[model samples]
Target: MSSSVTPATLDYLAQRLDELAAQFPTSPDAVDLVTLTDDIGTLGHHLQHAIERAQERFTAPETVYPPERVALVRLARAAAGIARALDTLAEALTYATTGFQREAVEDLAHSPLRNDPEVLRIMTAEKYVAARARLRHTAAALRTASTPAGSSTPRTTGLQTQPAAGPQPRQPNRH
Candidate 1:
């Protein structure tokens, strides 16, 4: 089952893509990773609408030819993969930013954010199992980055260092 999207929605998608592309970092660095991930994550976020629209159009067979339907299916599948990867990459990057707590793996897995239907959709996809494991491994690396030489845990920087409990930039579906 699928639904229809209006021309105005498609226009908004195109415009958002344009805006993001223009805002992308001109010269990238460690700091730029955040911006890059944010832009790419936004792209992935918006791509979901394209997938939905394509699926919607595919269901409305009378409006498009057989070849068009085939194309729509292809686009939808492609969009799904891209969106999942984008989110995964962002998750990995964000995980790298802070000190890893052994409890974080469980904290995030059981966190309330996991209950969100959309976040669940991406997280439960086949790729996320590895992403979760990577989070574990990444946490070990964080142990190194976060703590002082003698400490076993992250030192307080007086900085709010925790990333959002789940896949970050978990954008609201903006279709």
Candidate 2:
């Protein structure tokens, strides 16, 4: 299975895993763990799409006569592992959240950003608006980079890319 898997596919899978690992908190609370679950889910979704794309490419009639069934099986197993891991993490988060005080949990749910005044300020600033536009542009470039060669359009994932409805009213500097 390892032999049949392409280097590019493995690299992308490893990169995605690295991203997930980087998001892991050393001493995570219920909220952090829940956020990790969401990140893991997104990674799993992207990995599934990548595996499907690879399978389609390898199984195409124009290429090799015999398909690599072992590689496909390995990919499928990896995807299942991802799903199981997410489920387990969610269960753990549920337990953690249950152990916390109801009011604390409610606070986490209602206003996670309330503790970080700088984040709130930055989020409303004109600079953040410009940075968000730049981020969107960069995300578009990354989508292009991940696209398979010879494909006309970039592959779509669960991520959405909607334009802002109107200009944001920038808050005055509060230093």
Candidate 3:
């Protein structure tokens, strides 16, 4: 099943690649493209693995939990996206040059999507959508986690709610 990507994961993946790129041997002396590519390669593989696991667990007929299934699906999508991005980075790295052979390349190696406008925009969009979906899941989880047992009142769930004061005896109506 196809899954949507999230910002947290994207941010996490991007950061990993950024860190790796820091190890590349570039003109600036401090640039580390080779290391970045290696790091991203590893991250991509792990993301692919995550997608596979999510596929197995979520797509299984035996699992009936809607929320969990959805979460897994989302995770799978995000993982797939990350994997693809990493692949793209790897390809880009192969032809990679430093010191203004390409302006886009410089941007990419610097900021969000390494500061390349197109890459940054794409990553931002993916991150926003994914983050929203994750927030929804987190909210749902919080609601479920907070739900009280055997109480119909909306205010009476979990440890957050104060215990009822005391049992009150019913009084008979007097004329």
Candidate 4:
């Protein structure tokens, strides 16, 4: 894509992830499951927007169909992926938990009546953290695999190159 992810967008995503993480153990008890459900939905919405922006800004012009139309199609596919992930997670949580708490999350995740920006913001953060953690873990595993057994990463030395000598001339001084 021609347009890279902007700093502002990264910051926005980070802020949202932080908010979502903060609500974890406490928020679950406070409002039941609405927070989690809303967050997941928000994540889906944000991904949809992101995919649209990416295709519009990054894709080459010679791609057959119109830019906006192509972006929309890609956006829909991305949104569908997010929705499926949310549905699976929601179903698992519902099946695994009991009482008002489970009900709350289930309702929020599946709710057709409400859509809150705050909740979505938090959910977006949740997804970011989860994805980042996965990336870090994968990186660590790869590093470990690539490293030689019992060998530490090699250190760098600060040395400059010297020019090779070809010939030297001698000078005589007269008294």
Candidate 5:
């Protein structure tokens, strides 16, 4: 399948990963889980291809030199490590995603509607469904938000909707 991810994009991602490696990584509430997990999975798949290529190169006739063949093995191992690193990244993102969702829901616990019959009913039911709905609702808002993350005000609850008043008819353009 064709990919929009180019060699340059991977190279840049490598560079960014290298830059982030020096930092102490612990940010629970900072969630980019949606894209990061998918990206990491893609990167791991890319590394799997590289690992296979290295194995093929190692067995090539021109690679008869033992040291050169060993180098190919090392290359494959390093690519395998990249997949492991991607796994670590995926784990971190999962933690952040969970943390963010939990925090958002916990905040909802303090809302005035907490004692409302409908709200209490949802709380009493299977919470995973509610948790997922909260995450999806927040994700949709965040994607379309014009303002900064935390600063964005709640527009609607559970689902978004246009005002009951419909849109005005569009005027034809005039020269």
Candidate 6:
């Protein structure tokens, strides 16, 4: 494979991950949390596919494959981690919503008034607030984990070296 092609492919994969990360809901509702979970799973699948493709590409002779493979594997792991985080967030939301509803109903049943719309509404709102906070915290943690450590410096993968800064003197074209 041409050197140019490998970096382009990696860039595409990185862009896709960025897009998925951006789609995470800042204030996720129950329905939104479910959708986000599914989306995160899908992103994980895509990352896995990328890793497989990178491995396959490695079979080509005399090509720089090890570094690319390492990078792809790292990305796949990050994607899986993010998906797990999203799953945790989804579970927390489901639990909060259901537990709150159950407790509210049970509490109301024991009271003189069996059904109070205002009380139910207040409980639901409180549940939503608490769940939203948990989701935001989980999302923040996922973002932190997904980012590569020491990202301030360019990563040196395998035998490839960074190109020197400034414009290169052009080589004369051979007739």
Query: What is the lDDT of every predicted structure here?
Result: 0.40, 0.39, 0.40, 0.39, 0.37, 0.42
Model 5 residue 27 CA deviation (Å) reads 3.5
Instruction: Kindly provide the TM-score of model 6 when superposed on the true structure, using C-alpha atoms.
Output: 0.39
Give the best candidate by TM-score.
2
What is the number of residue pairs that collide in model 4?
5
C-alpha lDDT of candidate 6 relative to the true structure: 0.42
For model 5 the local lDDT of residue 61 reads 48
How much lDDT does candidate 2 score? Answer: 0.39
When sorted by TM-score, best at the front, the candidate numbers are: 2, 6, 3, 1, 5, 4
In terms of lDDT, the best-performing candidate is: 6
The digit string of per-residue lDDT tens for model 2 on 33-107 reads: 335445445645654664665565565434422223333444455555455544544444444444322312445
Misplaced by over 4 Å in model 3 are 1-29, 97-175
Segments of candidate 1 deviating more than 4 angstroms: 1-29, 32-37, 101-175
Q: Write the per-residue lDDT of candidate 6 for residues 1-175, one digit (tens) a residue.
A: 3232234444544444455444444432322434534554554455455445545545653453354444555545544544554454444444434554444355644574434444433443344344344434433433443323443223323322222222222223211
Candidate 4 ranges with C-alpha deviation above 4 Å: 1-4, 26-31, 59-88, 96-175
Superior by TM-score: candidate 1 or candidate 5 = 1
RMSD of each: 21.3, 13.5, 20.1, 23.0, 20.7, 14.9
TM-score, structure 5 vs. true: 0.36
Query: At residue 76, what lDDT does model 4 achieve?
Result: 41
Candidate 1, residues 56-116, lDDT tens digits: the string is 5656566664444443444454455445545665653444343122212546654665444
Q: Which is superior by TM-score, 1 or 4?
A: 1
> Which whole-number lDDT from 0 to 100 does residue 85 have in model 5?
60
